[model samples]
Target: MTTNRLWRTLSGFNLSTRKWTQVNPRKARSQVPSNLLSLTSWNIDAFSPRAIARAKLILDHVLHESKPPDIIFLQEVTTAVRASLLQDAGVRGGYLVTDAEDQTAFENVPFATMTLLSRARFAFGSDSTEASEDDEVDGEGDLMIGRVSRMSLPSKYGRDALCVDLIKPAATGTSFRLINVHLDSLGHTLHYRAQQLEILANVLRESGCGGGIIAGDFNAISPEDEGLIDMNQLQDAWTALHGETGVEGATWGVGAKRRDGLGPGRLDKVAILGSKAEAMDVLRPGSIEVPRPGQESIFLPWSDHCGLSCSFTF
Candidate 1:
């Protein structure tokens, strides 16, 4: 939890600009296993009603999935949610967290942002003394992190992609990136979200990994948002498995209480730019019982936006 050592059992970070610019203090291991890589994306709505209890429920639901996802993406992560995630046993034991608290690395000005939980682990270089203080590796060579960094995106609400380099060193000698992002939310058209999507796609394209995922709250309220996939050279998991108009694929306004008078919308999404998709569904943590001052109990959805879950080979 110290400011200097992230990925060291949830502890340092560096500022990455475009690509994998950070020196590979620890070389990537062999190519990723030919197994289905699971992913989940959600905007937890940290600014709304009961954030603390919802944070706990969110943690319990994701970590205990019937088949837990390899990578989990969460948006609307307030300081309280981040702190709870850090203190949780499942997060500390199962995933390597990003340093959202550090301004030098990731932007901390956003009222709510994104956090990535990855189960990918890496191997260090031959020399034991190769790691410097800033290197986010453990004493042993099995480093659970390749590198944790972020890149700024154009948003009126201060949005950025929380990029994590998964050390699946392919035979071609290029590792892939798993980026978590919460794109701009104001525009009714794809104007703002389109710009953000392009930037995320650019990062994947520049990496030459050909196989990275940009999953989070895309705020894809517009119909044209689907075309952005072709525009950005990426594949959408929703369309791949469930098709365009599958009611089951809807994430937002589904399992939650919506008073906006809006019908169920698939706002949260997972777009890949994958091995292949095996299964896909929405995370419906029906409701939580909140103890009131004198009343018996009240039920509420964990988030205003239901989380999206997808599984594909890597």
Candidate 2:
């Protein structure tokens, strides 16, 4: 994508520090849908068929259940497999944006390793477009250092990341920005990760979207990992809406890997920006469910990572 075109896509961005007057608490709407929106985020480890099946089952339940989510954001999608899986699971509308290589030469980058799937419209970043005058051989050689492992064939799969914008129906007048990302699992250090967060922060500030939601496998636990993002600019929707702060909130480790309890800490997350946090009707980190039998519990193993979902009112 040309610089000019990229600027066009980011036209709404503004650097002004002037903030909008937050609506008073008394006027806010806190009663969200009783069933809550069912949104799930799973790593779906690439090259592992087991993880794929686990991810599919989660989707099946969400589609089958009542009070289906208005949107779903899925990460770690290698290609268009997520869309196909959703279709097979009976989801009616599917949209996706994967960072597949169209280059004839080889390069390496983690962003090229996966894709993002959502039941929303997609707007890609400008860095994805290629110009005819570009030198292919030189570009390929420069990207050799960032190559994604496990692939015999090499291409420009790791250099740049992809950004997708998921839009709800315009008639409904409800929308948000869904960013699916897999930060450098290697290469760049802590500072680099922080820089990645900064980039995202700036994007939200500029996009001027009504409600912005970012969901992904951050690859780092919150409040502990250095350079791991500080939730200062955004609030974990589950924590903010539920008013709980405890260890059980973790959402990783289930399925084939095998975990005894709720797994090891919360790595996957769904967050709302402070700019729009007040709009949330209700948010929770677990699946919406009903108590059955004498079990007296609504817990059921859904996937490797427990899903997080929320509802926002305009």
Candidate 3:
């Protein structure tokens, strides 16, 4: 099926009882500024109940804010969680989600992969003209969606990256590409991660876009690893915003015990290419805490890894 047809079919699947309105250009323009775009990336741990709850909380917090994130890039999303997210009241009302699962789906385990959720109002493409109820199915809007595909990576677990392109104010040819990836897990070595990064970098270079974003659970321990340094065009948002003092920006191992041989580390990252970075930070909800067995309590994050968000004004 075509992308527009697929999007419409997916949107029509009402897993929730609440009725949702179609994208309104006037409301979208009024709610979200054209120049400002906010994005958040998180590895929501296979969509466990606790993880989903926390993810909902984070989304709610942002949606209520004066300026909510325009797009959300999520990794480690499972088929079940994808359905749940779609059925979520807040999510249903605000965003349109698209997902690509790993090629190999284990027998009982939900297929895991990357997912992107774009706010309906702020979605890029189209002019300022509002579509009437009858015109909703015509797919006219402020955001023009284009070229979405799932590229497979060389991995035992059948990992893949979901790549998508968006044009803001459809008339303007200006566009940006967004890539969400979940590389091999701990079972893979640094060299393997490097190989995967190389494939991704090659794809980006070949695309030849003016600017774009690559973000997700890279599983790379250091900046030098994963061939990141080799990509001269892309800048690590964490490093650019925080600098040397921000080395403590750990997003993984938040729920592990010392005996588990896991501790806080920066495995997840957001890399920006050809865009001016405005701000970047880890999103840690106050309620997240790690528990200790009758010892001094430690704060455990909502997931094993914390969420990261970056803002850019082009």
Q: What TM-score, to 2 decimals, does candidate 2 have?
A: 0.53
lDDT of each: 0.63, 0.39, 0.60
lDDT of 1 by residue, 80-179 (tens): 6676666677765555456534434334564455454443444333322232224345333233344555676666777767776554322233446678
Give the best candidate by lDDT: 1
Instruction: Order the numbered candidates by TM-score, best leading.
Output: 1, 3, 2
List the candidates' TM-scores in order. 0.77, 0.53, 0.74
- Candidate 1 structure, TM-score to reference: 0.77
lDDT of 2 by residue, 1-314 (tens): 11111110111111153221111112112234312233444555444334445556666665555655545555555434543452352442332323222321113322123332322222222221221122122211111001111212111223223343332222132234445555444333444445555566555455334545556655554344422444446666656665554445555552324433333655666566633333222122233343566887554443445555555432
| Ranked candidates, highest lDDT first | 1, 3, 2
Which residue pairs does candidate 1 place in steric collision? 5-11, 5-12, 6-11, 6-12
Q: How many pairs in model 1 have backbone atoms within 3 A of each other, for residues 3 or more apart or on separate chains, i.e. clashes?
A: 4
Task: Pick the winner on lDDT between candidates 1 and 2.
Answer: 1
Q: Tens-digit lDDT track for model 3 on 1-314?
A: 11111121113224444443234323433334444567888777764345666666665665676766777787776665665666667766666656422223323435555444555543422321221222222244445555566666667666767776655543344456777877777733566676677666656555435567778888876445635634545688788788744337878765456675656677888777667678888776535544467898655445666788788865
Off by over 4 Å in 3: 1-27, 31-35, 47-52, 100-111, 114-117, 120-141, 169-174, 222-232, 254-256, 260-262, 286-300
